[model samples]
Structures are given as C-alpha cells and as structure tokens.
Target: MRTAIRLALPLVAAAAALSLTACGDEDASSDGGSGETAADEGGTDADTDAESQDSGQDGEGGSGDGAEAGTDGSAAPSVDDLMGNWFVDPADPGRSHRIVVEGPDEVSFIESLEAEGDLCNRGVYADGTLTFAPEDCLQQGAEPWPDRSATLVLNEDGTLHVTWESGLEEDYTFSESEWGTVA
Candidate 1:
C-alpha cells in the first residue's frame, strides 16, 4: 500500500501540471481572440477593395483630371481672343472680309477679292512667322496659286503687320477696330 500511494502521488502531480499547462494555453488564445484576428484581416481587405473601386471609377470618368479637357484647364484660346471672323474694313462694304483663325495652327481667310471666293487653308504661326498653305495644294490638279505664305507680327501698340507673298508682298497694318471676335 505504501508503494501504491507513492506512485499515486506522482501521478496526481503530473495530472496537475498538465492541467496548468492546458489552462495557460487557453488563456493566451483568449487574450488574443480568433474573432479579433479575423476582424483585422477583413478590415484591411475591405479598405483595399474600396480603394481599387475608386481608382476604377476614375479611369472610367476620364481619369478625373481636368488637364485632359484643355492644355492646363486654366484658360483655353477662343475665337475672340485670337481675332476670328473680322471684316477688314467694315465701313466699306466691298472691302469687308471674313477670317477664321482656328487654334494656333490654322487660319482661313474669305476675302471679297474674287467670285471664286477667297481660299480656305491651314497655316502655322511660330516665332512671329506665319506660313499659309491651301488644303491639298501639292496634290494633282490643284490651282497654281502664287506664294500662299504670309508673315504676321503683332506690334506692342495693338496692331498686326501682315505680309503676304502671293505676288503682293505688301505689309498691311490692321487696327484692333478692324478685327472682331467670332464667338
């Protein structure tokens, strides 16, 4: 009976130690609950999904940047600002003309010079030099028009000096009153 009690005592101690270890593990797991772990992961994923959705919406709405609408979205060139659709001499009906300046690269003039109607063409202005060319002028059967280039210099005193080389290399100074905005 003494030997059995000795063995029984050690068994009981071993059981107690096992129980303590199991309890400690349970407490650690409870301190940092599984529910809290799951919630943290779910919240992170939800935030990422929301950000991706917002980015996708922006791509659909033209990138959500106004720069694509204009050069810088600050100010855009207008017909009035560029001297569009103006009569050379409004007081004299016979000398009236129409000018359509499109953007910074194209200029079309409809003067009252001939019945074939003033030509419509494209031109470029750079470094105070303007060059005008008729549409498809280099193509076959195109009219053999004279030098269709012109140079325009804007004076500081609100006047424009226009020089054309169509057998009439003449310089004309136009006042602000002779030009009007189109729109």
Candidate 2:
C-alpha cells in the first residue's frame, strides 16, 4: 500500500500543478505551432474555483501544438497523433496532470513534490503506454523511484485518454503551450 501511494503521489502533484497553471494562463500560446484553445464547454472551469485555492504546487506547466484537422475537416485523434503537451485530469476530482512528449517515443511524466521539487518520470513510449523505472525517475536524492506506468489513448475529439495500472483513468485535453520541439 505504501508503494502504491509513493507511486501515485507524483501523479497527484502533477495534476495539481496542471489545474493550477492552466487556469491562470488561458491566453498563453505555443511557439512554432498553433496553440490549443481552452475548452469552455466541458464544464472544466466549474472546478477552477476549487482548484485555484490550492495552486501553490507549481509543476511543469505547458500546452500543446494545435491539432491539425484531418483532410475531411474532422479531427479524429489517435495515440500516435498526440505529440505535444497534454493535460490529464484524473478520475479524482481537482487533480490535473500534464505530459510532454518529444514524439511517440520520448515522454516526460512531470509531477511536483512540495519540497523535493519536480519529479519527472522519463521513458520511451511503446504500444501506447509509458513504462517507468528507477532510472526513469532519477534525480539527486529523490525518493525511491516506484515503478509507474500509464496508457495513453486519443479520443476522437482530440483529447488524450489516460489509464494507469492502478485503475485510475481520465481524459486529458491538449494544453495551450507546447513543450519541446516535435521531431
């Protein structure tokens, strides 16, 4: 049980950071690419009031490149189609998570720890999931890196779908600020 919490803490922190940062910068733009506009119809902002109260946990804040509409003028999203900043809202209310990917292969799972700073679980993507190990979460004097993994799927509406091994799942939308240069 301890191990589970250890592994899950970072994710919660990441969510906290995401929600906090996203609310403050609704007009932020991504560089070298069109930015993702904040969705106002999904009732996401309903939690903004509650989320704003706990915005101190500053995690890696970012947005994603604008999704290109498919040839048919309809954007059908796929796991392979997501290659930039994506925000994750966990099943548990009020927790927002974000991930940045260099491509389908390189990814960073970022979470903020109160005193330990940012805990980034780095790994390669395969079969639509990210697998992490001790080395993946490596940072000087960091806590024992608990094994963590999450599956990512893309929704037809261009949101990134996420499911963790622990049965925690949520739908994440593209953020307005892109992280790294897509390759």
Candidate 3:
C-alpha cells in the first residue's frame, strides 16, 4: 500500500496541479512541458485555493528555527508562492535550466542543453520538503531514479535553494521569461 501511494503520488500531484491552477500569458502556449511565466498565468487574487486559506492561519507553526521563513515566518513555500519562471541564478540560459513549478509535483523544467535526467532526482515535494522515495520509480519519457531525491527550499529573499541528491546545490531566481529580466 505504501509503495502504491508513492508511485501514484505524481499522478495525484498532477491532478491537483491541473485542478487548482490555470496559468498562461497571451503569448504563452498552454502546451504540456512548455515553460512560461507562471506569475503572469492570468488569474486574480480570487483564484486563491482553499489550501492557502488554511495555511495562512496555521502554517507558521512548522517553521523550524526561523531559517528561510516567509514574510510571516512560514518556512515552506506555498504552491502559489512558487508560481513563476525560475531560471538559474546569474542568468545562464544555456547550461542549466528554467523550471516552472506549478505545484509540489507538477513542474515544467526546460534545459537548454537538452540534458537528460538532470532533474529526474530533484526529489518529490510532499509534506513540505522534497524527498527521495526508497522505492525506485520512472517518469514517462525520462530516466529512472532508484533511490533519488533532493532538498528544495524557498529562501526569504525569494530565491529557490536546491541541493540535489548528487551533491549539486544551486539557486534559482524568478524571471518573467527566459529573455526577460527578473520580475
């Protein structure tokens, strides 16, 4: 049962992502795997999800030691807070990638270099942090990560701090688009 839940989590995550989010810009194509400006995805404050409503009331209690806390000292980045184009800091468009994390599980990452499996083990976000599953799993059209996962956190400075399981740590910043400056 545990194994099944872990395997099915991505699907559940995907569904939740689809149901709770509606994003796109006039120029942004709504194609699967297409990276775009999630912040500009066309929704108002009224689009806020129910999950966010409750988090505002009690999410701050989970803050551990006040490191990387949000505006209200909440440590984890809410799914809505993560909506945007996260490009590699220092702005390298060729080497690493630009990832749009629409939800804890639904991510659209584009690597200009076409590197395969670079993010296969970026970890699966659940219950706050990204975690590695003990059981091996495979993503459609991607490589398999057997015992793979990593650490991802949103800093108070609005930067994404990621330390992959492979000992690679990097920071990602928000941008309106690939060619656009940080927004």
Candidate 4:
C-alpha cells in the first residue's frame, strides 16, 4: 500500500499541474480567444456604448484601399478600409459563417447553429486588430468563455490574413462567385 500511494502521489501532482496549465491557457489573454484582457472584457459593453457615439464619424465612405497615412504622412494601409460586410463562405472550414463588418471598429455575426435570434456579440478590429468578449450573458451559457483578439491584414491580392495569439490563425481569399457588396 505504501508503494502504491507513492506512485499515486506523483500521478496526482502531474494531473493537477496539467489541469492548471489548461485553465491558464484558456484565460491567458485576448490571444486566447478575442485577444482582450480582463479589464477590456469588463468594459467592452461600455466601449460599445462609446462606439455608438463615434459611428457618425465613420461617415466618410469610400472603397477601402486598406491603406492609410502613417504619422510620418507616408501612405500605409489602414484596417479601417476593410470594414464592411464580409460574406464568409459557409462551405469553407477556414472561413466560417458570414460576417457583417461595420468597420474595422465593429463586427457582428448571426448565430450559425440557431438563426432565430439576434446576432451573437463577437469582436472587432481597429488599428488592424480584432477583439471579442462575451457581451450577452444570457445568450452564452455557463461555458468557459475567453476573449479573442487578432490582427487583420488585407493583401493587395484581396486575401485576408488573421493572426491570433491563441494559436488559432487563418487566411481567407475572396471567391469571385461569392464576393459582392453587403445589402
């Protein structure tokens, strides 16, 4: 019995360590999911409220060249230009559900499993980064939810590359048959 306990003790410790590591990975940062911190998640709803106030400022509508003027006044691509409804091909695993991008600042996706309700709150990219937090507590059940954040880069060839810290990354290219303006 003494030898059995000795071996079990190490096994128990190893199991505990692994569990802790998994939990840590799940809640580490926005890189884990929407790339938001605890403080950002807490204030995301407020940020949404604040964004409403600035929606009017985004009225300067034009085709997004994905380029902007840097602080040095040099021409650089801005993620803001990519803000618009992006119809993600449902058939593609790399590309999930269709996404309605309000701007680089906000994004919304209709619930894929269930289409009977409002859009499930997700994340958005501003300054070329996307961050999402759980906004609707009622809609999201008691699952371990994490914030997600990622940077968006639009290539001149019309491909979108998303790099996230959560080890989840994808690259999407527009399909001519499925590409069009969102109505």
lDDT of 1 by residue, 1-183 (tens): 554344334334433443344443434433532322211334223222222211111111111222112222222222233433333333332333334454456655444332212334465644444566655222111113344565553323222334456423222222223232222
Per-model TM-score, in order, reads: 0.38, 0.45, 0.43, 0.40
lDDT value for model 3: 0.42
Off by over 4 Å in 4: 1-80, 87-95, 109-122, 136-147, 174-183
Worst 10 residues of 3 by lDDT: 49-58
The lDDT per prediction is 0.35, 0.45, 0.42, 0.37
If both were scored by lDDT, which would come out higher, candidate 1 or candidate 4? 4
- In candidate 1, which residue ranges exceed 4 Å CA deviation? 1-81, 113-116, 136-145, 167-183
Per-residue lDDT for 11 in model 4?
30
Model 2 steric clash pairs: 15-96, 15-97, 63-175, 63-176, 63-177, 64-175
Decoy 2 TM-score against native: 0.45
Highest TM-score model number: 2
Candidate 3 residue spans exceeding 4 A from truth: 1-74, 114-124, 131-147, 178-183
Per-residue CA lDDT of model 2 for 88-143, tens digit only, reads: 53222223345666555456665422222234555666656677764555231222
lDDT tens digits, residue span 5-69, model 3: 44345434543443233233212222244322222255223122211211111232223433354
